[model samples]
Target: MKTLYVQVDINSYNGKLYDFKTDIADLQKGDVVVVDTINGMLIGKVVGYTDDTKATKWVIDKVDTTAHKARLERDKQLAALRKKLEARRKAVDELTAFRHLASMDSEAAALLTQYEALIQ
Candidate 1:
């Protein structure tokens, strides 16, 4: 199977980015990506290609079988953690709505803080 590395630059605050070899004819622009945010392994679509030096830069860290496995595992864990976080956020929203109905501003504000913490 053809694999691509999900890449990002520290300067860009965008969610995630990807880089792949252009030699693969099947890969096209605007493909959706499933990326390993840390291990540099993931699935992502081809957003576009650049002739810029960044695209051709040699990868300092070589990807190995073990690293690939670790990246997959880490992606799975992050997915689970995100689900839990969303649930907590929903709870916070519900509590805030209830507090609003009861005219409890202080409680609503506190719940908002809790919600932010859960997201972070």
Candidate 2:
């Protein structure tokens, strides 16, 4: 199958930003891309693809299936970690509410805050 691979740089807070290469064929929308992020590789579903001819020059690399699978596994692990973090946040919220309703125990509040901060 003839596939198009485009290079993209994703910032921590900002999202996927394309660094278009002049030599490569302009990528189309719905193209699958393997983005190399800070933590690891990620398979990003293309939301936007452009044919702007004035982009900067760069090299495009071919992505194999093995690399793609590894990216998928990494994504799964990241998702699980996010879920755990969210659960911890919810627990902290519950504890804070409980503290407000019942006791004004400073120790329990401090402990929950410490735990919540640690997860992040």
Candidate 3:
């Protein structure tokens, strides 16, 4: 009847400590291990432990180097895609606004003109 608190190095959780059960006698803080999660197998680091005896049912395992590497690569690709999309959206917004600037009222046109100058 042992309870463990683990900090998983996953993107979504960002190294948050989740509850788990530890069977090994020597498990301690700062130990890197793999865990079975609802999402699949994930790598985690043991940050704390307790004898509260409430079983969380999560199992620790040996590191899955393949899954770890693949997850990192996927995160990198996703980040790049998000950056590109943000840039595209900004450019589209600027272009569309600039195109209609001439048809705006005096105050709106003046504000847009000042904004365009600042952005440039």
Steric clash pairs (candidate 2)? none
Candidate order by lDDT, decreasing, is 3, 2, 1
Candidate number with greatest TM-score? 3
Off by over 4 Å in 2: 1-63, 103-120
Better of 1 and 2 by TM-score: 1
> Which residue window of length 10 is worst by lDDT in model 3?
2-11
> What does the lDDT read for residue 107 in candidate 3?
75
- The TM-score of candidate 2 is 0.33
C-alpha RMSD between model 2 and the true structure: 13.7
Estimate every model's Cα lDDT from 0 to 1.
0.53, 0.57, 0.68
lDDT of 3 by residue, 46-89 (tens): 76675545545565664436888899999999999999999999
Give me the runs in candidate 1 sitting further than 4 Å from their true place.
1-63, 104-120
Q: Which structure is stronger by lDDT: 1 or 3? A: 3
For candidate 2, lDDT tens digit of each residue in 3-96?
3334454444267566444233545554555554444655543445455545543333324458878999999999999999999999888867
Q: lDDT tens string, model 1, 1-120?
A: 333332433223355554434334343455443333454544444555554444542223322357777999999999999999999999888867766754657776776677667867
Candidate 2 clashes: the total is 0
What is the Å distance of residue 78 in model 3 from its true position?
34
> Which is the leading candidate under lDDT?
3
